[model samples]
Target: MPDETLVDVWGLAPAVLVIMVGGLALGLVVAAVDRAVVSGEAGRAVVEPLLAGARGLVEQRRTTLAPDRLLWRIGCAAVPTLALLSLAVVPVGGRTLWSTSADLVWFNAMEALLWAAVWLVGWGPNAVHALTGGYRFLAQGLAYELPLMFALITAGLAAGSLRTTDVVAAQEGLWFVVTMPVAFVVFVAGAAAFAFWGPFAAPAAADIAGGVTSELSGVDRLLVDLGRAVFLGAAAAMAVALFLGGDAGPWLPGPLWFLLKTLAVVTALVWAGRRVPVLRPDRTVEVGWMVLVPLTLLQALAVAVLVLNGFYA
Candidate 1:
């Protein structure tokens, strides 16, 4: 019996490995493909400018535009780096690479701090365009951030735990999206705006003819573009994990379900990028604050009432 059990365990190990590896590979590929598909006049208009700025920084003469050179450099590099680090704690599957109690709240807080870093980067550059971009980013950030937080809080309330894994487990029978459809939509819209994609691309728009990244060049620009793509992927993954019931499904496996859901969300963002015209900065900020924020908060309150009354149970 011992020998038979050992053999069965060995057989299952490979399958387990395949599922984990396949899920990761799928997420990366989908994100990359999404980026590639959108890399054109419409898309490249945003990316290419940043690349140009990075290249300019490297090849052109270095001019000290600001009094505090060190501060500027640090601001430019730190925001994206911090954003990547926060992603580490987010649970990808059965376990996160590093997780602690209440990790979900920590993750959200760290992720939100990224905007501050980005703002600093723009301000440190001391260029007209960069400053304008930074202010625009701040305006948009103010508008969407509250709604995003409410969405996350609603998920936590539903799960009754601040751990992402617990949240996923709580959705055994039905996804949170079904129970909180309005919150899901609100969260997605807020995330897209926060990430500066689609209609909210105003802060980095080519029509603003280069907003915050207008001054970046060479490797710095590359880093910014890469960071944006990675952020896009991460945000989509979060939405999948939170609302879609992270890896919950039948026959295929949990991780595959996770990847499929993430891909679908990322694809939608890319499609929206292509279909929607970039919004004016003023209009974008106005809509986000005046409309989406209150709507999301109300949705959260409804969700709280429903879950508390055991309607979702």
Candidate 2:
């Protein structure tokens, strides 16, 4: 094993290695904290997960009849993989691993992969509940995708660039959250859908017998669980970058500030996830098309008008 590698992999740059390990660790810790807070057993809550993981490690993997083994494997692993890739573009202070002009688009696209991943996982299982869970995720994308895009584009339009770093720069003095509260709210809702958290968890809800994941177990199940946490954490990190003025706080280093903001967003999402009522999959489509679409569109147009008049300038 290499002494300097986060995952015993060879040839990763120090920065990339740090971000990879740090991001995963951050997601895990936040998730444990959220679970503890929600269950009213804050003490030893963190340690409980370690024991749970040990149990999962020893559990047997289950299989179903006529399963698409390849797709099932790929889908099970892809969630966290995509999420880590998405996190690469998220700024920790003034630095990012691969900051590009297309970061906003990249972030959106990566999050969008949840649809395919979840569906594949469901379809691969060839079971009724699993397939239904996958279908619910696809339905979720339809509901949240457009509003998510417009909300993100609102930031890009204001900054006049699609770069995540640029969005942060544009928020130096005035965070977009102040001017585009509607967009911010929509962004959070969209993020929740992607994470299948909060009211958007119909796909895997009790009504569906645990839905898409009803068949998953062992390492496969662990990956999906951690991936969801990381996806939510990534969304929260992006919210900090795109709306809360990334790393612009006083009296703290950029990474520390970024961490603080990310934690705040994660806390909010977790709280909302527990408090919000789950929407039926059918109702989700209706609301996404009828309500969120028009609202986010209007928000985008309003942002366009403001940008055209040099409002943020």
Candidate 3:
């Protein structure tokens, strides 16, 4: 039985690795596309200027905003760096790089750290807009984080383990979304808000004139932008793994199914970015904490009761 377990684990390893790498690569590609192909105005933009800006940053002279430049650079770079590291803990395609019975909890905790790093980045810059952006991010964080945690806990209670692979397997007949549709919706909203995408993208919106990113330029700006895309992809992938049964369908290989699901989520994010109205900061704060949080908690209680009653079985 141990040998069979090892073999099954080994078989799943490559697919997990591919998904992780693909998540990172997709992030960079999306950043490049955003810089080059997609513009805020939505028309009369081309990729050449974007590539030129990227190339110019590499060739241009470095500028310093602080006397202690090294710390500043580290501050801007650390968030995405840590966020990418945490993505490894998230399960994809029936496995993670390191699997633990408590992996789901660990994954959620690390994800929270990603937000901490974002606050650090904002504080590091020492600029007014950056500071304001950072505080806004924290406010938004408070609004969405509880719902996100409750959603994960709901899944954990339903699956009877904190292992993400077991969560996927538990949905063999029907995805959790089918039974816990409300929780699923809350999770997606929380994920999107945490990612700072679509209607929740107020911290980085153009009206704020690139709020957190306003003062950033050259390679520093590139890294920040790239990191945002990476976070988006990672969040979407986690959503797929947790609630969508992580490549459980037949016919196609597990990895392909996983990619398809992630793509769908990504497309939704991008479309929302284009269509949704940016929420005012006050309204966002109110809705996030008051409405979303209570709804998610209620869903968690509902799921817990269902699981206890053997509805999941």
Candidate 4:
């Protein structure tokens, strides 16, 4: 919100582009690692998927009956766009571009766009499977998204500021994960949900015949998948910044510490994907409302109490 700390408007677009490419690449690697674990394949599984995605560069786009090509394309485009946007506010160590006083709010809003982007992708196809997938994402969003927002709020409250740099600085003495374990856990669950990874992947699952992606092919499909991975990476990076004492360590540079922490969180999520069972779409709602929402609310309240009592100070 403060002009002194905001990203330069002229430099913002270019920074977003550069970060998007790097983030997307890192996201693919994290996803590849996770995929290999889940499929019982070699660690080199990233190779085959890379080749397949490259082939998509030349693969022809497929169409569904009565499809709205414009809306569908917008949906495809939005996936990576939103992923790129998420990193704009978050810092790498203490360095960042496009940050603001309300960066936490900005990040959350960009992520909320996932629901719209996903639903549009599903709905534009005009098929039973795709439509159902779109609806499923909406349901999933309602369930997981609220708690995610609350978790971010809890962090913001603890820091006494909504900016990410402040959040990182607040963990100078101790990490938020130690003080707010419930919120951290809920936030991790929300990250998996944001990427629609295992245990929260109903919208894109095989049971619904690949759900929203049933009608997708070629590079559009590649981008869509990569976008999901990129989103997961961004969430991991934010978790590092929020809960893991961003860029704080003995030997490593700040950026290296940040990178290491992000990878650790992403790896944990990938491992969870291998071990956790998928929650049915119906059950997702029940758990989200009955379990996640109340838990995050209590987390925030607890942080508020601690903050008021100078526990963090």
Candidate 5:
């Protein structure tokens, strides 16, 4: 791996292709894992997601009366767009598509934008169920977003830089997960919440007729679901970079090790998410503010203290 940070060796076009194709592929993997976990049928897991995508491609799109066509379309498109965009700063093969001094902030910004995009999806349809879902997502975002930020900041604080590569490099000797496990847990949980996935899926829960997805069908539905899976995979990869020590295994090459770790994280997320019952948005918000906010803050403070003592030095 190169020692220099933010190597732009792969130009813009290639980077975009990598992020697009790689993200979609990872999203499929997430779907498969989730299916296997829930159905206890490994074979079905392999076939279901592909079949679902094909069906989505061929199915007719459903539309509600009095829909805001423009916002609905934009919101649908933005879900996957933002997911790929967020990956620009994530290091792969010891390099990122694009790197900034505040790579962590860049990632966080994309997630924040996703919060709005989801609300738009819920609001665009002009249906009571969809609008309710949108509001639910908004409420959910209020609860989880801050702790997520603190978790990201804790990694940056330990690295003494906001760059993703720097965070990985800082973990050369000790993975941040060892000392900042709370941040790791919160970060992954936040990712699941932001994606409206698993236990944090109140925004799209079935009791409200699929919530934000109530008014969507065909490709629109496909896009939102695809975006959620990809975002979860991206978060797992980012978690690897931030806490598990990006590509730091001994014998295998860096990229392969990174792939392996990412797969493990994805599997763990899906397996665990399946077992926990879906949480109500109101209760989730309460926990986020009352329990998670303080826990992540203390996690950040502890990392800061460790950094001051040159524990990372």
Candidate 6:
């Protein structure tokens, strides 16, 4: 409720805490939605995630011979750590934790770090399946990463600044989605791909024996799974911030509006993504290069023209 438009350096600690807690809460929401969709039991959605977390807390760690313990633990911890770090540049209530001139780049950098973290997770287990899964993730990344970059860059181009707050402000007259719908769709789909959720889950597919998570157990498993969910949730919030005019709804308090829009995005993403059959990693690459790359580039070009014509003004 405090003026979110003002950057409060003194309140930075609390802001970080809030983002962490809220991010985790959103993760839970994402889990619940996916559960409900998969099982067709609305009641189980809320109860199952909590029960799973509780079970994970007490479960014994699964061990493998010759595993890279240091890298494994570091990779597990970094999943959620990088997700939270990416949120630092996102405007929770019209103010970011740190105001950087290139907030968009900061967020993208965290995502790139996450790519390495996930590969490390796959390699640390030393199991053939785990390594395969890790490599699959890398392959999928090669497919989705460029289109995702263009999607983010498209938003930054329209705003004429890489700062997220400025991007949100530029939507005062028209949400970028109107001019850049392909970027919006590609952006959200890219989030699911990077998180390995729904259709883009080839890296963690059953064919590979749970893939990167094949050897994980107890707290390690929990961290990786929780990290995936949190990353998806954060991406949904970002989609809203980038394309839906963050906190710009009529008559509602800004933070509340932002929260509502974010929840809607997370729910919709889960519901829609769940129905698509998971693609093989190779085919995912085909679609990424053959379909998405060209589409997103064209979307960016159109936006650039709009920017040049002063349509935003």
**Best candidate per TM-score, number?**
5
- Tens digits of per-residue lDDT for model 2, 1-313: 1112222333348767777787788778767777876787888777776666676688898799999999998998998888888887787656567755688988888887877888888888889999999988998888889989999999999999888877888898799998888889899888778878768988888888989889988888877777777888888888989999999988978878988888888777777678867898788889889998898888889888988898888
lDDT of each: 0.67, 0.82, 0.70, 0.84, 0.91, 0.89
Which parts of model 2 have CA positions greater than 4 angstroms off? 1-12
lDDT of 4 by residue, 1-313 (tens): 4433324643766766667777877777777877788778876778866876788798999888889889899999899888878887767757566666788998998888888899999989899888898988888888888899999999999999998988988999999999899888888889888788888888888888998988899978987888888888888888889998889888879988888888888888888776877788788899899988998998999899999999889
List the pairs of residues colliding in candidate 4: 1-101
Model 6 residue 186 distance off true place after TM-score fit, in angstroms: 0.4
Clashing pairs in 5: none
Candidate 1 ranges with C-alpha deviation above 4 Å: 1-64
Q: Which 10 successive residues of model 2 have the least lDDT summed?
A: 1-10
Ranking by TM-score: 5, 6, 4, 2, 3, 1
Better of 2 and 5 by TM-score: 5
Residue pairs with clashing backbones, model 1: 53-216, 53-217, 53-218, 54-216, 54-217, 54-218, 55-217, 55-218, 206-209
Clashing pairs in 3: none
Q: Report the lDDT tens digits of candidate 3 across residue range 34-124.
A: 4433455434233543564476478543453662355557756765665575566556555666665686778777668767766665666
The local lDDT score (0 to 100) that residue 300 gets in candidate 3 is: 84
lDDT string, candidate 6, 208-248, tens digits: 99999999889999999999998998899899999999888
TM-score versus the correct structure, for each prediction: 0.81, 0.93, 0.84, 0.94, 0.97, 0.96
- Name the 10 consecutive residues with the lowest summed lDDT in model 4: 1-10
What's the residue-level lDDT of 167 in candidate 6? 91
User: Candidate 5's error at 118, in angstroms?
Assistant: 0.5
Pairing residues by index, what is the TM-score of model 1? Answer: 0.81
